[model samples]
Target chain A: MMQALVTCRGLTKVFGKGELAVHALDGVDLDIHRGDFATLAGPSGSGKTTLLNMIGALDKPTSGEVTIEGTPLSTMSKAALSELRLEKIGFIFQAYNLIPVLSALENVEFVLQLQHVGAAERRERATAALHEVGLAGMESRRPSAMSGGQQQRIAVARALVSRPSIVLADEPTANLDSTTTAELMELMSRLNRDNGITFVIGTHDPRVMAHSQRHIEMIDGKIESDTND
Target chain B: MNNFGILRTIAWRNLWRNPKRTLITLIVVTVGLWSILAFSMLLNAWAESSRQNALGLLIGQGQIHAAGYMDDPNIDHLMPPPDGALRDVLDSDGVAHWVARLQLPGVVQSEYKTLPITILGVDPAGEREISLVPDKIVEGRYLNGLDDDAVIIGANLAKRLKTTLGRRIILMSTGADGYLEEYSFDIVGIFDADQGFEDSYVFTGRSLLQEYMGLDDEIAQISFVLPDESGLPAMIDTLKAAAPDLDIRDWKQVSVMAAAMNSAMKSIIYIWLGIMIIMMSIGIINTQLMAVFERTQEFGLIRAIGLKPRMVLWLVTLESALLMAVGMVLGVILAVLTYFGFQGGLDLSGFSRAMEAIGSGQVLYPQFAPADFVIYPVLIWVIGVLVALWPAYRAQKISPVEAMRHAT
Candidate 1:
């Protein structure tokens, strides 16, 4: 049996208080195995992204607990959580968020720089990651100079350069065209299968759900369906 | 990247983000520092010139008079000679040059006009050694020998009396016994001294005044020049020990008006500096606050990426420091250019009389100690950083979520 890389038990996130209170996440329990490609599906206003944020340690759960590789995230210090994010988890955003001042290679190398890697080794790693995402000769191009899909590919290269244990992508193809979306999904799926890198993608896109090996659907801040493809 | 290196790069890049604003701020800072430098140098030059005029032209380094002569200097209170004991005291104190002077109130008459004036009787050769009298001869020549019976009259006094070089002037005054005494002097030189009073006075040999007044061995006062003004106290002690009855006065005592003018000029410079500091502080505070407002999302992103609250505060403070340093560098460059370009010479077409009254020449030359340039910019930099604290604190207090949600 594959070891569970992430486990959540009765996790709840509440915002504000009293009459203005919002239950962004309620009692979400899940186990995600190592090397799994999972898609979290939900309609707008559902808690799918919130759950992913919690699992990514971008936010905290108000109740219950979450553990990554048996280290409980709720008990971790902010510095420890930052270390976890830097060393173990990588993130890709739907908006293809890249520091406008940096070139594609520099954007990918930022994580390695933060990890205090040597400049030459960081460049080598960043180059390899960009090549793996099919952006080998475009390392010098800035995000604004690239297409949406190309920019998103650079974002993926940035996510994978540090060789993190899990890649959390939030609606990674929401802005790409159909052909570009297919190419991206295929690239991500290939990296997952070949490198044994786990992917936890939060999206409502049917295309994403259809391609994933496992799918979890959420509605009104609760899990509506959990299915294995 | 290393923290400080990253901070420096960001700061350098940030300066170009709003070039117009930065340029405007730099201009204000540069002009402000320039004004301070120019004003300080002008005032310093004025003070230096005034000191030189009073000490070199009129009072020398120190003066000696009858005990009550400062309050009422009358011919009856003339100093008695030979002042050998006082001369020995001044010599022991390392005074460079000493001269005895007899001051008498007289009516100086030329061919056409007569004017009331104070006649200064000096040892012609000793006067040249102790004062600027020899250099101030605008026409003819300075009095060379006591036996020649020649006098150097002020240019204005000679003009008033309608006298020329080699002309004769009659000097009449009351003697020590209150009887009218009269004498005639051959006018050989005329002096200006760039001062109104000095330009209106007359100078003759000391023995001539004593012989005319019928007090052959009497003197009005003794004056000496010292190398350093700081040595006045020791010099005064020596004079007191040598001649206990003779009163000694330093240049400071003789130039009260000059001292007051110097004090007022200094006060005005400090007040101007205070106002510039306040204005610069306001400008810097406003710039930092605007920066905070504009970079809110970027700051939020960094905070969310794991920078501590204190780090954010340090970042903002460092940014402010960097900005001030840039501004200060530009300001100092501008000030130095103006200072050296002016070559210490400032055209005083505007305040010529004020300059003249303070005994400075027409062109105001700014003089400043080296510390003034180095210390003031650093002080302004620190003040700029201190004023940036409000914006830095505000940045630190901003929550990541709130900061991300708000638009710039």
Candidate 2:
């Protein structure tokens, strides 16, 4: 009975129009509660990523509504949405999209810098975030100098540095090997348990699904089943 | 970190992301600005040379004459020497030097030839202060005093008249009684000057010419020089009020051709600047747009991480501004070095005939104006940043979703 941090009511997303129209999400409704480590799991064309993007406010729904803390996202301006994302939401991409020119520490501090954080506190929080993601001694390393797993860890550190209300990760482990994927999952689970940080991951991997407290299966632009462990 | 600090860090780092492109653009800006500064200075020197050559011929910075003297330089148009309010004004603070002369049309008869000429009756000491004719004596000597009773003619005129320094010549002009009066004087000096001046002018002592013309201290013109000519208008106004019957005119009115050339040179400078600005704008726009297009996904990634469109625009524009600023600094340094290289003046003696045609000296000295250092660089930078804004706007308009589709 935890209060919903994110709510989607009869959300729909269509990519095109007319006979060739592709419905990426059709009348989808969902709620993500606080402290819930959730995963949207499905096959390739199943609308899970689209639904995640809608929830993350990265894309608009064709109809219905998406709300974060009861504030409708459709009503916010682009700049307001950006501000909301900066203060409340974190993102980890499948490619580990870190700014190549920035050091690992700078990458972690970039969000706080955008929020106009003081230099000393931004450095302290970024260093601690990197340490929590097991990247303690690699603060000065650029993304190009690090391995795939190490880069993804830095991305995670960057995501968690600002202490956002929710983390939206789209196929975060899609480029990782089995050992690195299990390690990343364990790290996310520990963060979720200790810090009560909510996570919504989009993936087709069952190993990723096993770590989620709430597993939602999507098929053909619709939620086929929702199961909570 | 502060907002500008972070933006600057990213902008600086991004400038060097592709070193080759950055350096090439930097060179473009540097060379463009250097050429603008160098060529502008050269044009300025050319204009200044023309003005000096024209003014030094006979007109000083300004002149005073009887009301109708400029239209008709005869004995009837002469006025008494400066005194009263006119003398007080001429002797005031700003006037550097002034000389009164009785200039009249006449003919010179030498041993073998007779030719028409303009005769100038000058005070030897005063001419030394305000006249180039004093220094141009290539042979013999200038008249020592008002009572020397000698004359100096141009070398070319001496050649035409089959005469040389120390030879006697007969000067003839209409006297105060409206009849022809003739005076014979020994030729004490032969001077070399510009072709027109060499062919047309003769100089003698003012007292000797005045006595011969049956007048007492009468002068046809008063030519003066000021330390700085910016006060020429005010000085002219004061003199006009002081001597209402006398006409006071600045060198620009006295030397119409030189004034026109000066105006034309200034126009050419602005035309050249416009052309350079167009070329530099094209180079800047291409370089910045390429950088934006190359980093489309990176821009998207930042946007997804909560950077507003305006911030993206600012970051990109800042990058370009940094590039332009560094290039402008290097260009200014290069120009200053080039100017020092010509410390002795850029010699155009090899093109002496061409230089003489335009009334410039054999040596051209490049001058450094405040506009060269402050106005030009700041202008180029502001324009360069403005030109870069197109690419920044493109970066701002990049859709995060579309960019993410190109990810990995």
Candidate 3:
């Protein structure tokens, strides 16, 4: 009965047309509630990543609608969508996309700065965000100087610093080892519990599935099953 | 952080990511600008010396002649010496120095050769202040008095005539009576002027020539030298009103070749500017475009993090502005040092013959104008920013999809 932070109804995505047509997503319905730590687990070429991108407002769906907090994405301009992404959503990629030239602290502060936060508050919030993710002493180090787990932690800090409504992570632990993956998932699960920030992760890792409150199985371009913990 | 501050920080950091590329582009911009500055100074030095050399050759800064004197050089086209109100005008502060000369086309025969030349009948006292003939005496001495009856000719002319100092020569010209007048004169001085002037002119005292041609108190022209050319127009107007019967002309009008040379030099400078702008514009476009293309993923990352496309454009432009500033500073410093290297003057003595052909002297002192400093830097910044816009536009077109990729 909790309010849905994101709603995907009969969503479909097609990459090409005619004989060369490829369906990246099929008709699917899903609801992501506030504070839900969910995972869309499937093998490669499934529609889980496409679904994540649709809900993140990063790409458009071919049919059906994606509504974030009752605002339909189809009606927004590119600028409005970008503003929505800045204000409402956070993203973590498997590759850990951080600006190489920026320090870990600067990476964390990047979103807050985009939100036009003041320098004093931006630094304070970014410092606290890094500390919350157990990266307190590594704030000034660049991504190249940090390990895969540390860089993912910095990415997590960057995502959570602005207190976005939903965090859409696409295979965020693909590059990490089992120990680091469990540690990162536990840190994210704790943040999800404490901050009430919803998480929608797309992955096939059982370790990731074990930590989620809900798990949806995807095959090809459609959702095959949905289950709750 | 403020919006521009954030943008500037990223832009500044982006430049040093590839230090070699940045330094190479910096050197290109620096050398391009420095060449414009240093070459302009060198050209200006040569132009200034050529103008001085042209002005010194008997045609001071301005001149006054009888209404038809320049049209015909005989005694029939002569004007009365400066007197009455005209004398007072010449004595004013506006006129630095003035000399009366009865210039006539005549023949000089040294027994071995006969050459046609223009004879300048000068006042020794006045010529000392305003004429090259008085100061260019390489042998013997200048004419001493109005009745001295001695002539000064260039060393080249003396060699042509097989004549030397103290040698007697026949100076013949048309008299006031419309008959041939012949006078004997001693070669008092052999003056050495530039190549062109050296071979065509001979100088004698005004009174001696006046008496010899049977025309007393009549002169062909009165040349005046001013402190500078800025007051030349006003001085011309003042003389026109004071001496309506006489024709007044500026040195530019009297020496048409020098005027043409000045105009041609200005055109060449504009051509140099055109060439520099085209070359530098292409250089900036390529360098800035390469820098933009190399950071496509980074651009996309910033854009995905809520940076607007226009802001990406601004970020790229900021990077170019920084490069321009560094280049301009380096260029000005290098140009100033290069100018100082010519402190003693850029000696063209090795090319003395070539220098004389164009009327410039052997030694040239290079100096820059204040406008060169202000104009060159401003031009570089404006042109650089404009030329960098294509790359910035490409940066703005980076899609958010690129942000998903790993850095290269």
Q: iRMS for model 2?
A: 1.3
lDDT of 1: 0.79
lDDT tens digits by residue: candidate 1, A172-198 = 898989999999999999999999999
- Per-residue CA lDDT of candidate 1, range B1-408, in tens? 665555555566666667787777767777777678677877788777777776777678778888888877778777775348765666654887888888877888888988888888888888878888788888999887665588888877777777788899888888877898988888898887655765557888877778888777777777788877788888888778887887877767766776677788789889988999898888878887887888776665555444556767887888788878877787777777767877757778588667667677667666756787888888888988998888999988776445543521
**Residue pairs that clash (backbone atoms under 3 angstroms), model 1:** B41-B366, B79-B219
lDDT of 3 by residue, A1-229 (tens): 7667888898999988999988988898888888889999998889787788789887898999999999999999888988998999888888737888789998888889889999999999999999999998888998999999999999899988888999989899999999999999999999988888889999999999999988999987898888852
**Prediction-by-prediction clash tally:** 2, 0, 0
- Measured against the true structure, the TM-scores of the candidates, in listed sequence, are 0.80, 0.89, 0.92
Q: Score the docking of each candidate (DockQ).
A: 0.19, 0.64, 0.48
Per-residue lDDT of model 2, residues A126-146, tens digit only: 999999999999999989999
| Candidate that scores best on DockQ | 2
Off by over 4 Å in 2: B71-75, B91-94, B105-117, B139-190, B199-217, B227-234, B339-344
Q: In order, what fnat does every candidate score? A: 0.05, 0.71, 0.35
DockQ of 1: 0.19
Provide the overall lDDT of each model, using Cα atoms, as 2-decimal numbers.
0.79, 0.89, 0.86
Which ranges in model 3 have alpha carbons more than 4 Å from their true place? A1-3, B68-76, B107-116, B162-172, B180-184, B402-408
Top candidate when judged by TM-score against the true structure: 3
